[model samples]
Structures are given as C-alpha cells and as structure tokens.
Target: MTVQSKQGAYHTGTYRNLLLEFGYSEEEIQRRVLDNWTQIFEGGEDTRIYYESEDGLGYLEDTGNHDARTEGMSYGMMMAVQMDRQDVFDRIWGWSKKYMYMTEGENAGYFAWSCQLNGTRNANGPAPDGEEYYALALFFASHRWGDRTEEPYNYSEQARKLLHDCVHKGENNDGPPMWEPTNKLIKFVPALDFTDPSYHLPHFYELFAEWANPEDRAFWKEAAAASRAYLPTTCHPETGLAPEYSFYDGSPNHFHGFGHFFSDSYRVAANLGLEAHWYGLSDDLVQIADNIQKFFEDKDPEDYRRYTIAGEPFEEQCLHPVGLIATNAMASLAVPDSPRARAAVELFWNTPVRTGDRRYYDNCLYMFSILALSGNYRIWMPKN
Candidate 1:
C-alpha cells in the first residue's frame, strides 16, 4: 500500500485490493478511475462558481433552477475536503456560503436553489433539499477543518438549528415530521417525497452527535436507519426502482406509475457519481447498490432504449448512462479495500464535472475513491 505522505490521509494498498476483487490489476482499476475523472471533469473548474469556465458559466446562466448550482457547490466543498487541497478548498468554500445561503427568504429563511449571476441575491424558489444541502455542507466543513469554534463553520450552527426547526421542530407547533410540512406552517407548503428510502446520509448523525442534544442521537439515527432500510424492502422487485414517494410509516406512498425515471434510469450513472465508499456496506445500502447495479449492468440494450418518466412523456435513447454512472461510481470509490473501491489519490488527475468549484466535488469524488481503493487494492499494486 502507498504510505500516507504528509499530504494525504489516503493509502495505496486499499486500491490494490479493490481492483483484485474485481478481477483486474490494481493498475487497471486505477487506470479506469483516472480515466473517468479526467473525462468527466474535462471542462470542469475550481472557481468561486464551479460550473463556470474561463469562457463562461455552465449552470449559473439562470437555468431557471438553482438546484444544480447549489448542489454543485456542496459537491465542490466536499471535493476540497477530500483532496486536502486547502487553497482551492478555502476560496470556493467562502464563495458558496456567502452567496447561496438562504438565511432570509420569503419562505421560513430557506436556502435559495438558484443565485443571481451578479452574486447579490437568489434567483428565486426554494428546493425541498436546498437548505438541507447547505446544512450538510456547513456541518461537514466544520468537521473537516477541525475547528469547533470558527468563523467559516459558524454557518453550521445556524444551519443545524434550521433543520431542527424544519425537520424536527413540530414541538413549536402542529406540523408533519421533519420530512415535509405545510409551507404556511412556515412559508411555502411544498409537498415532499417522503418515501424512496436510502437513509445512510453522509454526516447526518455525526452532526447530530456533534452539535445536537445527546439524547437526540439515537433518535436521528433511528429515523435515518428506518428510512434507508425501507428501500430494500418496499421498492419494486423487477426494476428495483423505488417509488417517488414513501410514507412516514415506510409504506409505498406514491400513486402507481409515480416512480421517477432517475431511480432506475439515472441510477446506474449516478452510482458512478457517488462520492461515498462502497464497502462496510450496510446490509440495506449494499442491497440498494447491488440492486441498482444489477438493473443497469445486466439489462439488455433493448430494455435500456428510450424510456419515459412516470408522468412525463419525454423519451431519448440511452447513451451508456454516463452522467448517472459517474454518480454511482463515486459511491464505489468511497469504500476502501472493497470489491468496488477506487483510489482516493486519483482525484488530482481524475477531474470532476464540477470544475470551477473543482475543490468541492472533485475532492469529494477523490475522498471516497481513494479511501476505499487504498484499503483493498493493495495486492496488485502494493506500496504501504
């Protein structure tokens, strides 16, 4: 295994082992990962606005929604932490929190899904998950920087309090569980997709444990655990596709034909995009990943061709499901010494779709990949 240098927390042996399990040389797996990184992040950037390149911005041009831009920021921050690219990480980190945070909005101080190009105010409309993303990022960034009481991470404290209010604070008034509440309860009564499982959210509990009341740890863990477990049990068998909406009771919530194409269609590619490890797989998550992989890798080309969303009729031919594939692949990279792990160090060369905020997403993708691949893929490319 490659020994941890002063620069990296990642080791080399892990990647070697992971590749061997996949029945390939460590170099081959490393090669594949490196290739994917370079290709996907081809025109990617590491600027204050990640999607933008030297010539112009990608998603920042008012794509009508800030979902991609906001999420992209989170991805960039995450990548920065993983790569240990302190300089790249810090600048983008500051840029995002300053512009994208939705601390004061028409909606109960929700995070804006889109930001204006001028960098002054949000474009409009809040996404169901936007605030959650901000909170998640702040909490993780605080943890990554190893600073409990710092200026930058100060965002985390407020972010968490908001989540508690929105997701958990029915105590203040009558409302639904943290999942979804009437907007009037606060502002914008957006219906939520309650079901669809996969609760193993990154750093949720750690944050709860770190910042929330101690008594609340198990509660948060249980809630998340139950949600994640629901997927393997309640999802469709043939497609392993989860329904768009799940119930508070873990029952199938959405109406028939309500499943999102992203579940099955985007899943394959999304798996590749995952920035988490694939190992130490919880029985449920492993099953979810396995089920998703089976559908994609095993499906015939005929089955893969032109598909429609549950409600929409748009159709297009599948072109290897690259976008979603990278997402999923990112997950596999997270777990070191796994049958699926990728090397974390490869991020330097792998590149990410999130270029301008390069440190954010790129670092994240590398973090998981290097961690998992190093622990397992040691046999073929031993160094440590």
Candidate 2:
C-alpha cells in the first residue's frame, strides 16, 4: 500500500500497481490492459471508437452522438501516448489540427469542442477540460517520443503555446481566458464564468508548472494548489458527490441545470484517484475518496443514477454506469487500505469495457481505470 507520507510518483518515479497488490498476476494485468485498448481502438464497428481518415489522420467518434468531440480526441491522444503508440498519437493530433483547431476567431488557439463526422464544426466554443487534456497529453508525447520539426508534431512547443493561450486568452481583450486570473480556477468553457469540478486535474497542473512556458510557470504552480484546495469544497461532505458545474467559491451553480451529479461529475472520483496516485494523497483528498467509495460500496452498478450532492437519487438512470464503476475503482488509488476500495477494484476488474452507442465515454474511463490500477498510466517526464 502507498503511504500518504511518501513522495509522489513525480518525485520518486515509482508508482504503485494496486491490481498487483490485490493479488492479480502480472501477465493477467498486462493482457487486460492491452485487451481494453484493442477493444476501444481496433475492435468491430460496435466496439471501436477510433477511425482512420483517408488523409492518414485519425479521430475518435462519440458514437452515441454521431460526432467527434475534443473530449474524445484529447482522451485518445492521452491514451495513445501512455501506451507508447506514437503513430496513433500523431494521427490523432494531425486530425485535431486540421479539423478542430480554431483560428482567426474569438476562440483562436483553441480546438472546437465538437464536430460532425465529416469534420464540420458542431460548435465553435472551446471546452476547458479538452484544452487541459490536450496540453498535458502533448507534453507527455513530447517526452515519450520526442518532438519533431513538423507543425503539430512539435509536441512540446504546441503544448506550451496552448497552455499560454489557456491562461492569457483575453489579455489583449480578444476573448475570455479559460481560467479566471484572480482565483486560478478553470472555467467550464472559455466563455463561461463557472467551473466543472471534474475538470480540476491538479496533478496535470503540477507538471504544467514545470513544463509550461517559463513566464507562466508560477501561475501553473498556484493553480495546482488552488485546485487541491478547491476540490474538497465542491465535494459533498458526506457522500463526496460533486456537481457537474459550480461557482468560483465552489457552490453548485444551478443556473445551467448541470449543478447536480451526473455524467461529467463521474470523473471527479477518477480525478481524485489519479491525482493522489501521481502526486501523493492529502487528508482531505483521502476523505473525499473514502466517502465516495463508502457511498457506492453497496449500490448495484445497474442502479447507478443521477443524484443530488447530498446523495438523493433521481428517477433518471445513469447514462454510463460502467464509467461510474471505473471511477469508483480508480478512487482506490487514494484509499487503498479501505475495504470499500478493494471492493471497487474487484468489481472493476471483473467488468468489461462498455459497448454500443454510448461506449465512447464509458470505455475511455474504463481504459483509464484499468491502466491506473495496473500502474500502466504513468508520468512520461523528459529525460534530463
């Protein structure tokens, strides 16, 4: 078990394989990880989300929506880099540059949040969560495979410039920044005033502080701390459920009607686990994970549903129950010693990647959870 007092993977270059700790064999873990990736990226029509374009680029489609999204694209890139699939990474990045990258608009330097299957824009605005993931995935790609002189292949430079634009978008009054300058909290979108708790990935920000443009390093550092402090506020004290959207002060923002726990909120548990695994756990963070695991320990996966932060269930069924299971399994990274944590990992290990119309999001979370538990999701730092 990982001791909370020990250094994080960032400092020590050592990661805990929780699946191994639970007595799973190394070969089984390896096979499970590979199988999950294959199912999502190369399986049959109903299974795979990735598609190779005629131009040699690739894109991951949101099968349920019949469109491609920056969310899936960025996630595919992250998975590709983590799996050491440089070909897939470059293909996805190239596709993103050609189809999603915005230019000569209020959203310049940002990727379009959604696009049709034919590469037409579905929306022109940017999602902060996608931008953050793209930046971090690019950085990891640069470290793992080294950057190239080509346009989008110059991964490090691309990541730095994107990060610069994220925090400085409105400096010349062009548009709103993704993050609020005063509070250091990332807004849900560039034009939005509120934030999504699931978008708060402090572990990524910590690395951004060290690898982002030198001028913006301090802001990234402060942003990391701010997020760590901010997360607990968004979580329900008893259930650890977070709203999909919230104000800068961490209060749920009901204006957008996404102020309840739902699909987006499912990422909160996974985020907390990954953050603790990469950067070590804190008391508050541990309690948040503990509460989440405890709340779900006895609940049937089939019964997962929309809920209030106070744990009140709605009549609506959860769209991605497997995603919820995967995230709860991931939360074990923070509270590995808890009995609830073990139950989560066991449940997740036995569950298969989701298939059908809504497979994209569920499978992505499933892959991440498996990689994380198997210690395959790692920090790809540049060799100094």
Residue 1's lDDT within candidate 2 is: 23
Clashes of 1: 86
lDDT of 2 at 133: 93
- Relative to the unseen true structure, what is the C-alpha lDDT of residue 181 in candidate 2, on a scale of 0 to 100? 95
Report RMSD for candidate 1: 9.0
Model 2, C-alpha of 139: deviation from truth (Å): 0.8
Clashes of 2: 0
Runs in model 1 lying further than 4 Å from the true structure: 1-17, 20-68, 120-125, 128-133, 148-150, 155-159, 173-203, 210-215, 244-258, 263-279, 282-285, 299-315, 318-320, 327-384
User: How many backbone clashes does every candidate have?
Assistant: 86, 0
Off by over 4 Å in 2: 1-6
Instruction: Show pairs that collide, candidate 2.
Output: none
Give per-residue CA lDDT, model 2, range 1-384, as digits (tens): 233655567767888899999999999999999988999999988789999988899999999998889999999999999999999999999999999999978999999999987889999998989999999999999999898998989999999999999999899988889999989999998787889999999899989999999999999999998988999899999999999999988899887578899999999999989987888878888899999998888789999989999999999999999999999999999899998999999999988888899999999999899989999899999977
Put down candidate 1 lDDT per residue, 199-265, tens digits, no spaces: 2242343345445545555555554444344445544454444444445443455356534444323
